[model samples]
Target: MNVLVIGKGGREHALVQKLSESPMVDELYAAPGNAGITEATCVDIVETDIDGLIALVHSKDIGMTIVGPEAPLELGIADRFHEAGLKVFAPTQKAALLEGSKSYAKAFMQRHEIPSAAYATFSDPEAAKDYIQAQGVPIVVKADGLAAGKGVVVAETTEEAIEAVDDMLVNKRFADAGATVVIEEFMEGKEFSLMAFVNGKDVYPMITARDHKRAYNQDKGPNTGGMGGYAPVPDVSAEDLTFSYEHILQKTADGLIAEGRSFTGVLYAGLMMTQEGPKVIEFNTRFGDPETQIILPLMKNDLLQVFEDVLAGKDPELEWEDQASVGVVLAANGYPEAYKKGMPIPQINGNVYTAYAGVAGTDEQLVANGGRVLLVGAKNDTAPEAAKTVYQALKQIDNNTDYFYRTDIGL
Candidate 1:
């Protein structure tokens, strides 16, 4: 079958690589794909250019469409395709609010009795500042809408919290995404991520992967999408897993369905294990970047089949390798801040898996284009050791660019 994957990130590259391996797939194409995906035929139209994507699909006679990013899904691209009788794995616009609007998601948590953080929303800058001052230090400031996964800011002090709010509201940093803000009391705990295939009724959970969001090695720097990640997070007890499935996952599916919305495709829950229990930190409508690079490598089954089941609204069983996987993202120096691009990118060993993100230019040699350049992945007996091995393997690829990556992903 002819398939079209959307987005231009490591996650999408992983999708492209896996789908290519599936015998069920006849031809594959990616929308606005990056340098890492040059091996896979890529189109140039950006994902947010929905009209262009739709036209391409129709012209190419694409049989199936898989969305890799949340922005297009939130913008109702899936609904558009479904309306045109095209098979798509993503949910309709009405159901996408689970990740589209933070305010709506938080409100849903309250209504469904799902365990989540305490939070307040604001549209006025002064009100946000007032709320921040009243709340004291160590809070999370987030833009109400999508900001390319760079919207949320976790403040460690009261001063930081105030500045974060002002940055979003007063400074117009995030523009429309920051027009309205969500501030929540900071919950101290370890974070774990779970991405599952959901077709409204059926829920197929993938293996858990924890992300290292901090830009620096010691978890002190700013967040830049994700620096690295590992699958099958160690020490996450079975009880917490049950709580996530019973309270967070099950409740979420039932609640969305009850509200006349059927979520199809990926449901990613970013959870922080608090003292009380596992509470949701946030929800993503699709897969995680570095996380996906590792998670896809561990999946033993065909991705096209799973996506097909989602599009057909059928229950599909999911399977994954027992071994653990790890992924580390390589970024140009000064990422999540001002940095240069279009630099020459060197190649990694043929054995290690590499998925590209910020890449432009044509054919032969790939070039660095985005904040995140590529994701390095490998699988082994355990997650921690695999992470270490991946780092060692990545050391061989050299471009001399001011690249940065976190050293302690699974450690």
Candidate 2:
């Protein structure tokens, strides 16, 4: 069957690569794919161009379309595809609200009795400031709407919290996305990413991964989409995994069904393994970027088959390799903030696998086209070993001052 994967990022690159390896997929295509996706034929249609995508699907006789990013999903691309009598793998706009709006997600968690941080929502800047003042410091401030993963601020001081509120509500830093904000009590614990192929009550969880959201080493700097990540995190216990699967993923699937929003795509739970147990920090309705770059390589099942089975309401009986995998992002020097683009990217060689994001191909070389250029991933017997291999490959890229990556990913 011919398949089309939507979006233009490392996550979409991973999906294209994995789906290309599937015998079930006769032809694989990516919409507005970046320079690094070599396995699939890249198309020029933007992900949000719903009419263009539907027309392309018809013209190419594409059998299935898999969404890789949240923007297109939130725009109701899936619904558009369905209306055109095309098969798509993604959630509707209403279901995508779980990730599109922080306030909505928090309310959903509260309504379903799902474990999460205590929170309050506010649209008025003064009211938000007052709430932060009363709650004290070390709280989380989030833009109610999507801000491309930069909406969250884990403030350690009241001043910083108030500033974040001002940035969103007053300065309009995040634009309308921050018009409403959700402030939550800080939950202390190690965080992990758990994504599942969810079809209403039937949820098949993937192996656990830990995403390093901080941009610099030792967890310093501003939060990014993700700096790096590793799968099958050694620190997360089997019991903890079980608890997260049951209390979070399963419960969320059931809750969405009860609320008349049965999810039909990747449901990502950004979880924190607290002293009490696993609690959700946030949710994403699509595959995570760097995490997907690492996790998909360790899966033994065919990517297309897994999607087909999940969509069919049948068990895919997911299988995974015993080896661990790691991926580190190569971001523009001033990433998660303003940075230069169009800088020439050095050639990468050897065993390491790569997923290109913000890059465009040139006749001579690849150039940085966006904030995060690409991710270099490697698989090994342990997370540390995989990270070592990845860093070694990253070091091989000829000296260039245009980019930076975290030194510590899987450690």
Candidate 3:
């Protein structure tokens, strides 16, 4: 099968790499792929640039295309691909609203009787501040739209809460995403991720993973686009996974379908294992980044087969190795904020290394392309064992600065 994967990030790179190894795959291509990916798979056009992608797909006689980013899905790229007679592994624009708008997802969960944290949405700065003060601290303030993973501020104190709301609503720091805020009541517990396959109404869970969302280590820092992740969490427990499927994930899928919206591709459910059981933290329409880097390699079935099953509207039976996976992301210094790009990169080690090509420059000398420049992943039969394998594999990259990765990812 000829597969064209959209996006150029670590996730897309991993997806392309995995598919390229599949016996079922005749050829593989990544759109505007990074330098590392081009070595493994053919490179196409830009992911966000739809016309270029479509033209490349058609010109190359691509059999199927998989979108790896949310921006294109939100822009209705799947609709366009469907119109062009191309098989795309993603949801429609209407179905994508579940991730496009924070408020919409919260409302949808409520309507579907999905368990989640209680909260309020506000547009007025003063009212929001008053509500925060009245509600107390340890709450969450979120930019209703995407803010590149830095939108949600889990304020630890009343002062921080006040500052967060004022900064978003009054100071206009978040601008468009903050225009209409979703101030959710913070639910404290162990947070984990559950990603599954969705072909219309059919859902098939891939693997369980937990991601370190904080930019720095010790789980203390602003939200980032995942610093690292590990699969088959020892702490997630068998009971917890089952409870999540029954009380959380199934409801979410049913709720979305009930709204006359059927989802396809990946369904990433962010859940907090609260005392009341698992409650949804949020929903991402596509696969998680660092999470994907780890999970996809553990899949025992052909990547093309799983996605083809999704496209054919079938609940495909999937299998995985009895192992865990760990992936660590290396980001440019001062990421999720102002930072320089196109700096020479140092080789880092790992079992599989992928570059996002965030910086369009020479690949021979590694360059800082995006906030997260590279991803290194490893797999083992145990989470702790997999984490150590990841660390050992990273020795392959020759970098001086001890790159950023969460020490407590699987702890």
Candidate 4:
């Protein structure tokens, strides 16, 4: 079957790479793919170009199209493709609202009795400020709509919370995405990502992964999608994983079905392990960037087969490797903010995998083209061992100085 994977990032790159390895896939393609996705033929249609994409799918006789990012799903690409009589693996727009709107997700969690932080939504800046002040310090401020991954701000002070409110509601930093805000009490605990292949109420959870959202070392600096991550997190106990699967991921799938917004595709829960149990911090309707790069490699089952079986309402009986996988992002020098691009990507040597997130050109001509340039990952019997091997490969690019990556991944 000819398959087309949408989006242009590390996540899409991983999907393309994995799908290409499937014998069920006769021809593989990626829309607007980055430089590192050599396994699939890259298409030029942008993810938001619904008409163009539909036409391309028909023209190429693509059997299945997998949506990789939230933007196109929020734009109802799946709905459009279905309308055009095409097979698309993604949730409808209404179902994708769980990730597209923070306020909507908060309300849904409340309605479904799912565990999450207590939050209040506001459109007025003054009202938001007042609430932040009353809530005291250490709160979370989030833009109601998608802002890439920078909409969230964990404010430790009332002043900082107010500032974030002003930025979203007053300064319009995130544009329309920030017009409304959801302020929540900061839940204290370690964070982990649990992604599952979801088809309506049927959910198959993947291995747990811990993503380092902070840009700099020791958890400092602003978040930039994700800086690094490791799968099969050692610190997360098996009991906790079971609790998260049942209370969080499973409940969410059932809730979406009951709400008349049945979801299909990757459902990612950004969760925190509180003293009480696992609670959702946020949700993503598509595969996570750094997390996908690390976790997908650990899956023993064929990627296309999993998607097909899930779509058919059949159990894929997914299996994963016993080895641990760690991935680190190589971002532009001053990432999570403004930075330069087009710096030549150095040749990576060693037994490691590379998922190009942001680059242009091909082969030796590849150059950094976005904030997060690429991800370097490795698999080993232990997380520490994988991290060591990945970091050693990254040292090969350190001399360029135009890119930077976290030094403490999987520590």
* Number of backbone clashes in candidate 3: 12
| TM-score, per-candidate, Cα-based | 0.96, 0.98, 0.94, 0.99
Off by over 4 Å in 1: 397-401
Candidate 4 lDDT tens digits, 1-411: 999999999999999988988999999989988777899999998999999999889989999999998899889998998899899999999999999999999999999899999999999999999898888879999999999999999998888899999999999999999999999999999999999999988999999899999999999888779998999878888898888889889899999999999999999999999999889999999898889999999999999999999999998999999999999998998888899987888888999999998899877599889999899999999999999999999888777788889999986
For candidate 1, what is the lDDT? Answer: 0.85
Q: In model 1, state the lDDT of residue 345.
A: 75
Candidates' RMSD to native:
1.5, 1.0, 2.1, 0.9
lDDT of 3 by residue, 1-411 (tens): 778888878888878878877787777888777766663454646667888888888878889888888889888999899898888898888888888899999999888888889978999988888888888878999988877678888999988888888888888887888898888888979888899888766788877888888888788888888888888666777887887877667777787787888787788998898888888898899988778887888888888888887778776788888888777777777776777776776665545554353545554665676888786677777777777776776655435452455555554
Segments of candidate 3 deviating more than 4 angstroms: 39-44, 350-359, 393-399
Give all candidates' CA lDDT scores. 0.85, 0.92, 0.79, 0.92
lDDT of 2: 0.92
Q: Alpha carbon lDDT of residue 276, candidate 3?
A: 83
- lDDT tens per residue, model 1, 1-411: 889999888889899999998998887889988756854678899998988998988988889888999889889998888888888888888888888889999999999999999999998878888888888878899999888878889998878888888888888898888888999989999999988888886777888888888889878888779888888887679999988988898889889999998788788999999999899999888887778888888888888888887667666677878898888888988998998888877667734678888877666877788898888888889877787778787777554656777777766
lDDT of 4: 0.92
**Candidate 4 TM-score, true structure as reference:** 0.99
Error of 3 at 105 (Å): 0.5
Clashes of each: 1, 0, 12, 0
